[model samples]
Target: MIKTIKHFTISSLLYGLLFTSCDLDRLPMEGPSTGNFPANEQEAILGLNGAYQSISTLDAASTPIWHVMDNITDVGYARPGNNYTSPITSSVTTDNALATKPWQYHYRTIARVHLVLDNLSNLETSMDEGSYLQLAAELRFVRAYCYSQLIELYGNVPLLRHAVGLDNADVPRTPKAEIQQFILDEMSEIAEHLPINQSAYGHVRASRIAAYMLKARVALYAKRYAVAAEAAKKGLEYAEGIHDLTSFNATIDVAGKDHRAGEPDVSNIFGHEGYANSAEWIWVAEYSIAAGNTHNRQYYGASRLGKGVCYWGPTQNFIDSFQALDGLPIDESPLYDAQRPFENRDPRLDLYCVRPASRFMGYQFQPQTEHRTVFNYWPVNNGSSSEPSSVTNTDATNAYRSFSGYLWRKHLDLNDFNSTSVSGESELNVGIFRLAELFLIYAEAKIEANELDGSVYSAINKIRQRAHMPPLTEGLTQQQLRSALRYERKIELANDGLRWYDLRRWGIATDVMNGYLYLNRAGNGWSTNTLQYIDENHNPVYNHNEATKHFTTQTVIYKENKDEYWPIPASEMDANKQLIQNPGY
Candidate 1:
């Protein structure tokens, strides 16, 4: 004889309520309404789908944003050779148009999960136990992933667990350390519930192994060396017997497409065609051109080589780090010639970048060829507010102008070489997490925890051995081992957007960034005339030289500070009044 409330929508009511309320009705009850779900079961499933959908959005793993984040560290640079200008710096810090996308997207996702968890208690059927567990686990994983991204981009974000309607939007910031711990705890729990084989759910969904991999990555960023090592080992174990390394040539092919079928190959590691489900990938952000959803290849790859978007160059320091084919450092290589810098470096350098004098797409690159500099444009003016004119023709005179002195090749589809069409329809799944990264993570953790013996060498040697390079010599000290680990990471993960974060976590960004900024200018012989040239109209034209004078030797230096963390977006600050800002914003 419970009192019935007609005003409550059937969708909002629990399964028990629906059964009891409609028991007297002779006719069959309609399924849950469009606005509501049967109870905890349906809603919970919806919640999990919502979380996965959030990941599918471009912003989560957008290549353009990833490029921006990666280039700021030691390995990459923005246009006008030796210039310090790029759109990323302008937008990422201050209130700019592009910054809003990442800030908004991440919070929107977190909010969806919060709503799901808040209403979990309303689920009615005991029969829904399996569904509930799976939903809860997936939601927790998504929440942890989002929070980690937020913390990395903007430190000290408000950790919201409950759904807050518009009226109560203002929540205070949580301590970074607390947030980190919470994420670790949530991921650890979710890992236990997730399935080892996600074949039923497909590669797009997070599985038990993905959770473990994420846990290791989070632990590493938190600087918990022992925990990081343990978690990384678990992730490695889960991935073991799952994927075998593809041959060098095959890996190169997978770099071109984003479909997976048949046995795993090297290209499979990269989400290329016939390789999306390869064992190498621990987590991936899926994209479909048919869905009208794609990454911003036009921004990263369009330059003079293709459509003339912007080409961010690589630093000399990065180039120098590549070992010669014989496993010798470039500086130490007998084949090394300072004048002919591009010759005899690691094969990866050639594979990853389109440098001067390199052959690409059946053409030997000349400093003055259409094909040579086609993909080398930078978004910002190297010196001033004036924008550079786009190169309409691929003639020799415009060839070097199109070159940023470097080209990005990783995660790009070379087959899609038409410069006139500037959309990223080419199918190449952007991998968010992969096994190669985990291997380096294990190596780093072992070294940090003083476990760098044969096991550590073995882990490091695997990556080196794959690159067809020699293994590390035995009996090295901790410092030497550390150097070797760092070098391995740089070569393997370069242009994959991990270097900047690696430098920050390793506490070397300030020194390395400052040193490179100095050397690029010095080596380029920056002067009034250095960056200037005559215009096509035969008029004397000035480049970024005037603005270059503003940056003294001192302007290039940065102190590694707590402020290394980016500021929380202003919109978030306003929405969550309770949220605290990081210090020195």
Candidate 2:
């Protein structure tokens, strides 16, 4: 919530109260140090903003945050240069910075929320009682949102719904089942007091849709499929009026896809100009170019543009996760031709990554060319160091950049590469939730609940139609539908910081992230194939000896129950003696 802390007058006065870690044993008889603040409407509004500021404690483009969230799952692989082997291999210790960050930021936000809620009984405002109730509901929504993530990440975390002083801070960890119910109950109960819509673009506030979104996600995580289904249905009803999926259907002339996809599908949703004022974003975090956003995601996600560290590389497993146009994996689908791997694949694969031989930002990406710059054309406006960004592993570039054979294109701003200073100033908001996500949630929840009715099919088809993929067959068993739903959710939500959470919730992280995450090939099976060249649109031509070659990559071990929950930060337990670490931590 410190993202917008300047608007709040109490920031300077309550700095320690807002940022300091809480002690849980008891509350002193004396009152809160800053109890006198938040006495008026202006102060109340500022306090609410203070509570919301922690949402951006980790930026959309932050490497550390993304490394812990995405790399540990099946969808992402971080550059090995950072030396974060603990998280990469699923053996992270309690003292890891990754463990400390969510603990600090989430609880810090919860503390702010408690401050606002505790003052709710005393504030006098010009707005009606309904308006005050709406504000109260929003504060609770923020608190519930943080708790939802906390319980999932570190099960049995202390649930501090109210302001706690040093003397009263040492509370025992609440069971996840109970914490999950609390979140569901709070969101559903407060949802009625909230309006259907709030006119804000920067994700500065919450609405009824956010309440239902949280309810659906948390309920699903708790395996309360019925509640998840109902909440998703209600959320869909509210979202239908304001947002529609972006499309890239060149064959069909639809309202949203009235033009080319590069503009609407790719640009508007993730790029600079589009994120500046996008309709697809449901809940987002705002940043200022003047004050500077936290990180340059465009630089990290890129292979040729901007800073071009390309901090991550997509695993071959993730590449294969995408279904072919025939809605099947490459091994099963008839449309999939090994000679033409990129062709006949899902458009999302092309849109979300700079795939082999694909045209990108007015140039072609040819990783097999053996040139420093993989792209046929490089933007020279930005300062250069004689060699292209492709020449990584040198003095100016990182050795692990894009070593995984693919780069992320989903959350990056394509236009932020104008210059050194401007390139690092991408203010693209991180969408906390999106309309497409709600659709998938509703579809999956309904499927799991054995209610494969017309509505379920309709909801899924809307998402599929946007991606220009084929629909589900006429009849599929519950098990079959479950399979379909699983892949759909994975592909649609990849790299948006939801993959790890989704895998853990579905109990599939152990299966998916079990082994090698393919980055780039250098020896044994890959070198011989580089000699044969093909056109950008052509499939790779392998020699007779190299035809049976298999690529080499890195390995990761997901420790089943052990890795499902992160450890409580060592410092947190030191501060509160009553706290116990999660199992196997």
Using lDDT as the measure, the top candidate is: 2
Candidate closest to the true structure, highest TM-score: 2
Model 1, residue 208: distance off in Å is: 1.0
Deviating ranges (above 4 Å) for candidate 2: 1-32, 59-68, 81-84, 124-127, 249-265, 291-293, 359-363, 372-398, 419-423, 521-550
lDDT of each: 0.56, 0.64
Local distance difference test, candidate 1: 0.56
Q: Give the per-residue lDDT digits (tens) of candidate 1, residues 44-137.
A: 6655565555554534223545555556555666543222342223223435334445556666667656656656656635536665666678
Find the number of clashing residue pairs for candidate 1: 32
Question: How do the residues 1-585 of candidate 2 rate in per-residue lDDT, one tens digit apiece?
Answer: 112222222442354354344331122111244566667766666667656655665532354253236755556777663234566577788887766668777887777777768878676455579868987898999989988888878988888767777667688888989999999999979998987766443545787887899999898888789999999888878877676676543422211221122221266676554444456666766554543335566566665433566566566557666777887765557786655666677777776665554544433444443434443234332445432334322211344435666666676654654532434544555667788888888888888889888887787777787788898886888887777777777777777778878777777667655655554432112342432432121112224344335554566778876888888988778878888888777
Q: What are the per-model C-alpha RMSD values against the true structure?
A: 12.5, 6.7
**Candidate 2 weakest ten by summed lDDT:** 255-264
